[model samples]
Target: MQDCRILITRPEPENTLSRERLHALGLASVPLPMLNIAPIKGPQEQAAIRAQIFDIDQFDYVIFVSKNAARLACDWLDACWPMLPVGVHWIGIGQGTTQTLLEEGVPALSNPGHTTEALLAWLKPAKMTNQKILIVRGAGGRPELGDKLAERGAKVSYLSLYERQKPIYTAQTFFMLPDVHLIWVTSGESLTNLTDYAEQHKPEWKCLPILTPSERVTLQAKEMGWVNARCAQGADDNSLIKATELHIGKQND
Candidate 1:
């Protein structure tokens, strides 16, 4: 594992944590952020988020899609509602998001398994009809969550607090490609950006072993011609590390 050179494609700050964790595990990590998060700063966007926060109590379930969603939304909620409204059940997608919510003084129900399917399975017993659900996430994410909730007769509204954009690549971007043995792609967008960058600069590296957190991302990688795309058990640093270890073990075998 110490000899494994993994390329992390998460954005900065988040990438830093993953790198540190990988380093602690004796794996070398190269940060190659494929996506960048930018808060929506327009007056109209701010007004819309404020409007949603103003009616926070009306929502029956508040779902946070990621840690970023929880952190960004709560930043506004903390300012508007000093005392969070009671009885609004908070749902976090994973442990990280749940921990962020707790840090923001928002207690939430989180799926220990760390996936949308896991969260949905956990919420299946709840009465969803006539319930108003608010989803806090980055702009232009998958619609499956809201669509599925709506299918169960819940009125789902989205409060997009941030937008994801591809970062501009430089000469240093290509420098890491030679040593990258496995690429850790956290999102479908990141995978797409990585493949796009590879097609243009290092097409020969497209088939490099890749690790992903979801089956959806694994499928995306395969469609993009990645030969060894493996899905980890969950969307966490520990899960990714374990998956990488297993992949390396198989290669050794």
Candidate 2:
């Protein structure tokens, strides 16, 4: 929206592109990252991750649930495989993750929709009766996909590569956000963190409009006392921009 300052609550590196896109469209934004995507770095964890990478071929389908997962998986897989093992299907949850894998030399199938339920539907659980699926993701990622697959008699496993940690911010940072007209929250954890902080420090900010990635999350926002919560079409920048346009147009009406 023109001149409307939106708070981008994505982690660094990723938020950089979001801010750039918003600015290019004559929108103002403030970077207030809610979470940090940090790789799992302990010695035991590293070995476990390495072992998963080396044994990647055994999984009939390997799913990269996010761009973070794709990036780390490609890096680790590159170290282990001069060429990706044949007959192992690569899957990504969205365009961003699929594109990341493509750029990293892993041809992958992206889910037709942005949500786990959509991906599960696309995979056709009936046919997955005996498939081996590996979801490569950050720690504490959603287990819905794996659980559904397992319920269909498929063997499901995970290779957790990173953890989402809440970022530390001073009181001044929270105080500086009064002019932010909208907030874009990408994940459940981010929404919870933002809601918790707002409830404690800026209860009035609950009235500010906010954008989430899906209808489910938008409902979550409303339940958390957000007066004008909205959901973007998807988790991509294009979808977010379209949603913002629709919102501002409504105000102009």
Candidate 3:
């Protein structure tokens, strides 16, 4: 029998996205969100973005780490910068990010494999010396992309557009998560939040399998007392579902 039940342990937007994917596959998915995404806005930050908007043309390349980043940057750019300069290449970290750019009418140069490693690998063979790279993302993200680009001779500028916060569980949120067969974790932050919740109510998640989007997330889940954690190669929805099915199949075998 297929494991018909699934638990999504991500932020709100991501939870809805994952649930839609599960629904497409004819599976039942429950949103047990652990993280919440909030836009970072302040007079100082707005001034910063406004000051930096005109300088975007100086950058040879721009990178968007997530859809939220892409949306926030593009929205701000449209309001301030009327014209997009030519020859500035746009790069997205993954399919979701790429789609976000496309939706916002921002054409990107490269849509490589998802993750910093793949994005950097795709850039390694290109001419990076003296290139300027602008990265739009959330706060507290890995600096691997910027660091790698800089090491490859590109000057990197980072723009923080939002922050990811651990959700303060309400009675409704608590009711949403209980006994379940599996939990899909897409990011380290989400996994950490899940672990924190599990610590308070270990029995709620003791036997559930933890499925992660990558090896890094798997390691984090394991560290958080999830012995049945496994990483899916592709971070896409289809890949995650296939990985979960295979893992469940293995258990049966």
Over 40-123, each residue of candidate 1 has an lDDT whose tens digit, in order, gives 999988998899899989999999998789888889988999899998999898777788899888988787677787777767
- lDDT tens readout by residue for model 3, 110-168: 45566777788788645988888899889888988888888878888988888988888
TM-score (all chains, Cα) for each model: 0.94, 0.96, 0.89
lDDT of model 2 at residue 91? 93
Q: What residue pairs clash in candidate 1, if any at all?
A: none
Expressed as tens digits, the lDDT of each residue in 1-253 for candidate 2 is: 5768888998877899999999888999899888999999999999999998999999899999888899989999889999899999999987877888999999898888777877888988678999999999889888888899999999999999999999887778777765778789887788999998888878877998898988888899999999888888577777788888888888888
- In model 3, which range of ten residues has the least summed lDDT? 170-179
CA lDDT of 230 in candidate 1? Answer: 87
Question: Which residues of candidate 2, in runs, are more than 4 Å off?
Answer: none
lDDT of 3: 0.78
Q: Which residue pairs in model 3 clash with each other? A: none
Model 3: runs farther than 4 Å from truth?
1-3, 109-111, 170-178, 203-206, 248-253
Which candidate leads the pack in lDDT? 2
User: Model 1, stretches more than 4 Å misplaced?
Assistant: 176-178
